[model samples]
Target: MNYNTENLDDKRLVALYKKMLLPRLIEEKMLILLRQGKISKWFSGIGQEAIAVGVTMALNDDEYILPMHRNLGIFTTRNIPLNRLFSQWQGKASGFTKGRDRSFHFGSQEHKIVGMISHLGPQLGVADGIALASKLKHKNQVTAVFTGEGGTSEGDFHEALNVASVWQLPVLFCIENNGYGLSTPTKEQYNCEHLADRAVGYGMEAHIIDGNNIIEVYTKVQELAESIRNNPRPVLIEFKTFRMRGHEESSGTDYVPKALFETWETKDPIANFEQFLLTENILSADNIEEIKIKYTKNINDNLELSFNESKIESSEIKELNDVFNIIENEIITHSSEEKEFRFIDAISEGLKQCMERHDDLIIMGQDIAEYGGVFKITEGFLEQFGKERIRNTPICESAIIEVAMGLSIAGMKSVVEMQFADFISSGFNPVVNLLAKSYYRWGQQADVVIRMPCGGGVGAGPFHSQTNEAWFTKTPGLKVVYPAFPYDAKGLLASAVNDPNPVLFFEHKGLYRSIREDVPTDYYTLPLGKASVLKDGTEITVISYGMGLHWVLETLKQYPEISVDVIDLRTLQPLDTETMFNSVKKTGKAIILQEDSLFGSLSSEISALIMENCFEYLDAPVKRVGSLDTPIPFAKALEDQYLGESRFEAALKSLLAY
Candidate 1:
């Protein structure tokens, strides 16, 4: 309330004026274009420009921002050329997303602007990540994220707030209280007096500002951004405003009371600020008109140029880096220098080596640091790497994943361990939607690996024991790696760390300590998307991964006469078709084993692929053996039958007879 504009010289005031006006003018022209069938759609930020413009102007140039679609001022204030901004709106290949996504669904890494998704809450979580990277890198940076009043209702909003506070992350959460989210009023959204009031429970500082007052917004946000950098912590600001138009132009504002709209119109941010400039004798009538004409011509020229640009073609949409680009590193050649390592030890060594090689590599999870995680895989890692690299997190799965993405954006690689693979359900959205689609949508490589400790037989029951690799294999844009042996586990993990894409690395808890083998003592890596022929023969081929591979090998010991070619599929996503088909062609029969249930599993897809491509080479129909189609039970008797040795024996017997 005590903020003043006297200290802001005429030059700075005029610059702020231009920033607020450009977005309004561009959106006005965009509205005309939408009706003329030139642009496909539009979101108007007519009255709410001050909140976006003021806040963006308040931050340092190097600080990152994540803004929603309605924040046109954030784009305009950043000085993104009108032509290029229009080009993006017009779906031109010259735009930030290269016409991959229209509107604000794409991020511009060059501009330090992270994009928004349809689901608003997750972006708030993603902001926590960028802030974490800044803190970890020892940079004087703060991340600002925006959302509407309704967005606070989501669990992700609360989860992110709690994580940022608990970790003391430097994140400035800005909420634009635009009265309504689509059609629902703020009253219907929550019972709190103000959205900022919710910050009390999280122990986060809160502030409410007159959003329509540009001077107040700029002053308060600038102060907070500076204070937060000096003493890092999370803070929330509720900017009170109302949208002049509907959520989108097409959805008219019939739900808004006419009286309320008229009242807000009188307090219009741009108009009030202009009147202040006039009252202060900073601008005359002619000067104001000249400014409008200058901007109008600029807007017109950009719009015409954008309309002339060509649309993006499908062929130009290829991703720059291959998702499963296997690093051509030397394989384990030191046979005599090898040492016996448990499956868990191999994983730990792989991560340790990767972290040592890539200085920016970070690992995060609940109880991962100090406690060394529940399985003790990262034991003594905290003392070795320090808390900055080996970070611990709250039970905010959603936020932790987003932080990994933020690290990726900050030129760092990360490994996120899901304490239990089944717990991924709590934070699955960002993994599937944000991290997986990041590169495909905007060419931002999500250089992160998610470690999923999964599989049954440990009696952890349904919530802990799960083979979720199938879920990711079905989702394009993610690499799924499941290794059976300790050697493969270490090598495949190193390859995953090398991959510049999102990888789901599944480590079967049942094998973490139960399985041990001679692994290379020196640093080495093996290629992903390549299956190892453990035992090759001509009678029949058996394919499997993770615990299923171990089960197949153990059951085959009973029948030595059965000449079977056993294949361990190291990476499930980019299936090694060449090796699988070559082995199947010679054997003339195949049986796929999996720890996951039969239906809609990786086995189904692999079987389908084999039937489609290798029909001529097949002597009998391809068979699949998997756990029972039911939730994994805690009872020992039921779990034994579910993943029984009899199932593997039956499949081998049936395939060999063919």
Candidate 2:
């Protein structure tokens, strides 16, 4: 269906034509820079400017947007300084990234633009989160997410759509069907003829539009945005357009068929829109010339300004050092009077206190709301708070984690539960890519907490009984905490919640219900990098945490001859090197123990820390005691043999002999 430009006013049609021209000019210049070796590589939205500008103009300025790498048109139209865009492409210090993030990872919170994530399709989930936050905050705003047709084939796209549909979130998912996914055509990527058709499975409003027709693109998006704002439901719009150039500047155009290029070139969105403007008499020849001249001058001025601007000083790094400095100038505001609470109760109370402090804080997972979580840690939360605060999500691990990351990015504190510790693998991508690297990449904090019931001892088979603390400890920018008792659990959880980073808080399934201890009633926080000395001795230093602390306590009682100093390294990311070194210095020997496998375990990290810091101080080589390389066995006898306790006994005997 063709859209007639005759219905629209001359000024609006001319403005649309100008917007389409801007991206083409910017992209044409960028291509020149690329060929001249001034820029490394880039993906240009040359022929697809109408789709970007139309969709962006359709939404309000207060609304949020998450765009993919090839979304320069949207960013440019949204007033992302053209010079910064050019600088980013040139890899200069004055670039949008400041040499830290990639060129396309641009965003401005002031402009209500959430940063773009590089991964395909995950932005849809982020859009959902932003929309949810808007709803909760009582803001009349929609979140529009842009991605390629190729992204629709990803599991994240389906998962995101399913979540948005279930929650009836206000999100506009725009798919730019640019024909090729880095040389592979859409027909080779998916079975569907139109990408918008796939949205029917999620029961969402779906439409396919001629992306080249600026009026049609704008009208459809405006209507959809209004529908979502009123009813707050997910909408999917597929824009059929084509890329005028190869996928990136570095890629050769040989892979694409000449016939396909010829066919698509005739249907170029910018060229078609320009022709429409002229035929409808919406833009005079003089007006077109004036607009080109104005844009050229503006682009040149921006380029000159950015080039001459002072580079982001490396000395400015210290200014950003305290960005996540949670402990800085913190007043110990806890009341002197304290009340008693159990470990499970403390976990629940800590969450409640945090939620009360931060209105943006949300807790969600399976059985989390009414059931109060699997272990009743979140019991009475739904009754005390509303369903919005304490949510019960479907048993979709990947969806839960991705949504948490999305919410966190949208300025919300999300605490997610992995019903079982072993189930965290399902949400590993969001944890690793979105959560762990977000701060480092885009200077945005992913302040999220993943509470998992970890460890073994109770008969929860191999599937349910695994201490996978090492899996996250190995990832940088992720803080892993294992609290032995209720007091520490409450304090550490409070600290993690207050921290401006992602934290993995592992609550041992064995200790959650079995172990009970007195916890402070008021809000109190523990230092993240500090360790606690459970017991002091001279001969050997036993470095352990979580369930291993119990074994260390028991072993010390049995072996009077082995004067062991037990140190609980609370936070794994910034391990207490000073404490570990001092303890090892006094003891002259070290033993690391944990319930996980020795290969690629937290024990290895502890051992490395010891060797790196106080190798000469060590009288004997640092020994590690952990589970066998094989998976945890089902039988009690086999499980006991496979875990760290047996190895701990053997290591202690070996250290005594040494």
Q: What is the TM-score of each candidate against the true structure?
A: 0.97, 0.95
User: After superposition, which runs of candidate 2 have C-alpha atoms over 4 Å from their true positions?
Assistant: 306-341
lDDT of 2 by residue, 489-557 (tens): 888888888887889999888877767776667888888888999888899998988888888888778
Evaluated with lDDT, which candidate comes out highest? Answer: 1
Clashing pairs in 2: none
Per-model C-alpha lDDT, please?
0.87, 0.80
User: Judged by TM-score, which candidate is best?
Assistant: 1
Let me know the TM-score candidate 1 reaches against the reference structure: 0.97
Candidate 1 yields a Cα-based lDDT of: 0.87
